[model samples]
Target: RDEGLHPAIRIALRAITDFAIPFQKSSKLYWRYFLVPEAEFTEEAIPQITAPVIEVKKAKNEVPEIKEELQIIKTMPNEPREKIEMVISEPKKEEMLTPAAKEPLIKNPAIEKKEILPEQILDKKALKKEAKKPKPKPKKQKSDKKEEGFFNKVKERLASKSIDITDIIGIKKDELILKVKKEKKEELLIAYNKRKITEGDIIEAHKKAKEADLPYSILNLSGIPKKIQDLIEALKDISSIEKL
Candidate 1:
């Protein structure tokens, strides 16, 4: 009657309680306290074991069936079978002297093409003329000029102030060439000074900007002259350079 427990467990408990051994029967008080009545348990239970009934089944021999099949196979008449073979021979290519069929055996197109003489395909006069004719020189490619930026004049003016303009020219040119917003450029310069941005970082940022279809040109710090770098280093405050 315990709904919380499995029916199989309840059935097992009931079976143990109902079929009492000599010792269990003698202990009336213990059985009365612990044993559950069979009527209180559910009839539905799993495979039960009571008496051990062993069934011995004799194995059937398949030898008689096999012998019968063999006899049937032997009684069957022998059927005649035909063997097949294939032989292929290429036609001999011999010159025919007869008026009809005088042409040689038809050759494979690939073989005929390989056997063709160079003289048959090329014109001797044309080959000689081509050899004698001078080859025209490759024309030098002129690079397209880039449009000058609005700050190009300002960059050039600042660059002229440098004692040796050769080293500073590249940096000046980059300043003019960069297409990024003025604020972003200032931020990059600040980041560059702080070592947050490197040459590789600038290049990678430029690539990412280009991929995103943004107008930006990266600066190459290494392109600046050592003299200009030294001058900047000597300067007490770098913020003053931002004015220029």
Candidate 2:
């Protein structure tokens, strides 16, 4: 049994030795080929990194000194100069006047020699009195003759007949003014009622007559009835009544 166990342990020891020998040899080769010399690497890297840091520190330290120099230049003073000389001028003297220059001379001999009379003295009061006097009265003007009534003409037109229907219907507002004259108003009323004259017709006639500038007095005497007159008034009051 002891000899069998011994054979297994010998085999395990041999395998382990074989692996260690190759690993050690490879490690030595890697270190010798790839790792550079410490002194040479440090010298090159130190200058590259440290040089920029030194320059930055020097610039920071010098900045305050440069600013101090600039401040000294700004605080310096300017120089003074000599005063300028001033000259003043005196005023000129005026020339003296003679007796002939001081004496007055007439511009126009004729105007200076002219004489004044008492009558030539203007009477301002008399002139004002004349102006204030009242003017003479003008004669009254004669007025134009008034237009004749339609009834007057109608009377002649209906001479033979007692009354004519056409005359009544045709009687304009102007003819109605004749009612003021000779009691003709009753005759006009009779005429208007006999014809059965409408308020609308009378209003239309009045409007036309007004447009023509016919006198109001003439329209008043026109033979239209009192009922028709009332109708005209009512028509005027009615808001919806058109001009006709």
Give the number of the best model, judged by lDDT: 2
Local error of candidate 1 at residue 115 (angstroms): 83
Off by over 4 Å in 1: 1-27, 30-193, 217-244
Q: Please report, in order, the local distance difference test score of every candidate based on alpha carbons.
A: 0.36, 0.38
Model 1: per-residue lDDT, tens digit, 1-244? 2222333443343344333321121111111223555344333442333322221111125347546655665565772221110001111133112323333233335434456667765777678889999999674343112214324443454346431111111132223333223532311221121213344554665665566565443334344446545764777565555543
Candidate 1, residue 120: Cα displacement in angstroms equals 85
Worst 10 residues of 1 by lDDT: 82-91
**Best by the TM-score measure:** 1
Candidate 2, 130-196: lDDT as tens digits: 8999997774343112223344554554454443322222433333322212323222222221344
Candidate 1 lDDT score at position 216: 42
Candidate 2 ranges with C-alpha deviation above 4 Å: 1-194, 216-227, 233-244
**Cα lDDT over the full model 1:** 0.36
